[model samples]
Target: MQESVQHKGVTHFTIVKILRTFSPDEMNEFEKFLHSPFFNNHSTILRLYKELKKFYPLFSDKCLTKEHLFSVANKGKSYDDQLLRKYLSRITKLAEEYLSILQMRTEGIRKDYNVLLQLSRRNIKEIYTRKIKKVEKRFNNFQQFEAEHILHKHFFSALKYELLNKDNQIKPHNELLVDSINNLLDYFLIVSGWLLNEIESHSYTYDTGSKRNAVVAPIDRNMIVEFVENAISNLHSEDKDRMIFLEMVLNDMKLSSPESGFSAYTNLKKLVYGNSHKMSRQILQFYLQRMNVYCLLENLRGTHDMHLDLFQNYRKLLEENLFGSEGKTNLRFLEFRGILISALKIKEFEWAEKFINENVKYVDEDLQANVFHYGYSLLRFYTQDYSESLSHNSKIQSGLLPITIDSYILKAKIFYVLGHSDSALSLADSFRHFINLNKLISDFHKQNLLNFLKYFRAIIRLKAKNNIAKAGKLLAELQTSSNTREKKWLIEMTEDLLKLK
Candidate 1:
């Protein structure tokens, strides 16, 4: 598990991995752990440790070959793979055990709780009782305001009760712990129901109009709906700062009556505005991400006024460093791309340009250029600066499936808008060929994009001669197929075409 990927034939991974993560003091302690007869009786494990120690921090294969280790382990005897594997496994096992114990020893609560349990086993009743109380006292001094903190406290308290029960006379104070655990569970399930609702709604929205939505009652649909609705009016019943209740309400509104989603969004904004500092970074990111999702649903339902507001929210959160690293991660360029699009959709052209230029330093150096060019190209296209868009398009050289697909489609869109119908159709055919030949994309994405390209080529050719109604009809068939990229855009395009006609 420590190795990033499995090297099936490479036997050095287990031992090299152990050494790679060790701190200097930890490595020293591990040396002692290796020498101890209690932990290891074989001297060959020590030999392996000493040999592996020479390459600590960067345990590359140059000096770490299995055959070399076998020679060192068996005193230059004939190389034996089985003998080599046996000692390697033995050393790796001891290294893993040592780290586990070391981690336990460094954690105050766990270390102390373990000692108390050991004392209980020794029948040292007075010391065990005192130590248990001390452990409880220490845990009490912790900041147990969050649900996770309370849950962990409850877990430890229950474990203490289990240990105490082994001696029929001893008992731990676990009644309040049980209460806390139940309350925490209640909070998690209710808040987590929002996540479940979102997953189901995407499927639901496919059947209904993106304009219509309702909360599908969860298994306990009535209670959950009532509890979520009541929590909005009675925020005091649960601390919004620690529990994710407002997001739950938002999800409920998005499902139950998305016409009410904007109201729920307002409620969420107020709650987040008041409690952003009280929330942890992870929680804040989560709240903002849900708001982004709410904004997305609103956009799908044709709420464009809030676009700038949501764009400003992205800037505000990015300014405050509230977004998680993944929002800016180069690995998932799509998320970062969404942020750029948010700014672009609101017509924050300068801000989007500035962001692409300034924020790319956070991306992996290898990927920064690719992300920037892909994003800049879309920004240019959306702003209708077709030549600049084409420049950015030429600069894109990324092989990532999402980046590649968007780049190809963006070039097609630009050519269509620029009255280069011949170029657009040519690009679509080439893009289709490239997609078919490439295995990097999933079949689902491949099919959707291919379908989109087909319709796009048809629509582009038809619309050039003021046959806008024909273009609109071409897209109406798409409404029944599983939705593809730019469904809302297609709908809006169809509506706009019909308007012109």
Candidate 2:
């Protein structure tokens, strides 16, 4: 008769003892057993463990760590080795649980598996068709860049898993996969730094304004193009990958040499085109941020064509994501207002008015005030509707957060537009006093105020039909001192006004 028996998990001593007792042939047999498909069943493996424990009394142990068991289970080669057997048992249990969960559609596992399967198929196709391999070989000179491409692909894989398994109950395993992907991304960052150093060294040739001609070999533009293209391709693979790629590309663009226009434009175009979506608001958000940087850089370099291209891209994005039926989110609305304001500053009135009318109701009180003020001010000066413009200006003045120098400037401009030369001159005088009293204007704004005062003063003189030559002199002085495109545009408008008089 069999005596009543109890079985416990394997301990370290039991594992060591089992290893010692196993002959080489027995160990080989055990390894085969551990690796066999028979060990894949969770309940069967647990039952076998209990049965073996009752008969042998050799596997009992209370102090075994899960990690140790996992190691032994994955690497053990002999069925006779108790430690290896126990690990196999544990793995079988885990896989069984995973399979059962998958079968049951529990916690969205069923849906996740479907998406995962599709993504896996796509990955296989990409790999088999040599798309990935081609990219890998194309940027061989920039290993870091190639590594980034690989890392982006891995990140997309992880993201697919995350989106598909979003509601899975087994968070620990999901987190482990996520951590592994992040580790790969970190490795890519290191590689990217190395590549950046190489590129910088190769492109170091620049004149320092000295008689000595310094010549540093420029990096191959073709290689840079290929790197950017790979990054864009990887980014378009998935949402998560796109965000990471855009952030890296934007940072690089910010630091890139002015001469790297092709690279900058390529990355910018990818960002604009690849993320044309309304569901994922982040796509538009990133697009706007990148456009802001691109536009500012182009404007600074006096590349009006490039600046206009960037602006038009932003306009299209606004039209698609902000005004379209898919538009949502307060942040996007605010961003739309900001973009429209920027367009107005460049005198793109048609675009500005179209955006304003479409987005009028969505604008908050403050933004509405500014939009009305800007639109009416332009209409007043250009269309000779001074009274209507002043009425809109009053609305803005009332809605302002607080009285600031900008408000005073707006008031002065309204007075000038309304042909109230005395009022405009008086408002300008008050602005000068306010600036001296509070020093609220930044240095940049100080320059802007000087230009504004000169222009408004000239306009007041012209309106009064007094000192025409003095107005002309003032216009020349303002034009000479103006250092910005917008200021120059205003100066040209003033010249047209003088000609009309």
- Residue-level lDDT of model 1, residues 39-76, one tens digit each, is 99999989878887776778765546776677777785
What value does the lDDT take at residue 57 in candidate 2?
Answer: 34
User: What is candidate 1's CA lDDT for residue 445?
Assistant: 56
TM-score for model 1? 0.68
Where model 2 places Cα greater than 4 Å from the true spot, the runs are 1-252, 255-271, 274-284, 293-311, 322-327, 331-336, 342-354, 365-382, 397-407, 433-442, 458-489, 497-501
Write candidate 2's Cα lDDT for 425-469 as tens digits.
888888776655643344444555565666666656665665557
- The lDDT values for all models are 0.67, 0.50
Lowest lDDT 10-residue stretch of candidate 1 = 2-11
Top candidate, metric lDDT = 1
Clashing pairs in 2: 30-78, 30-79, 31-77, 31-78, 205-216
Error of 1 at 199 (Å): 4.9
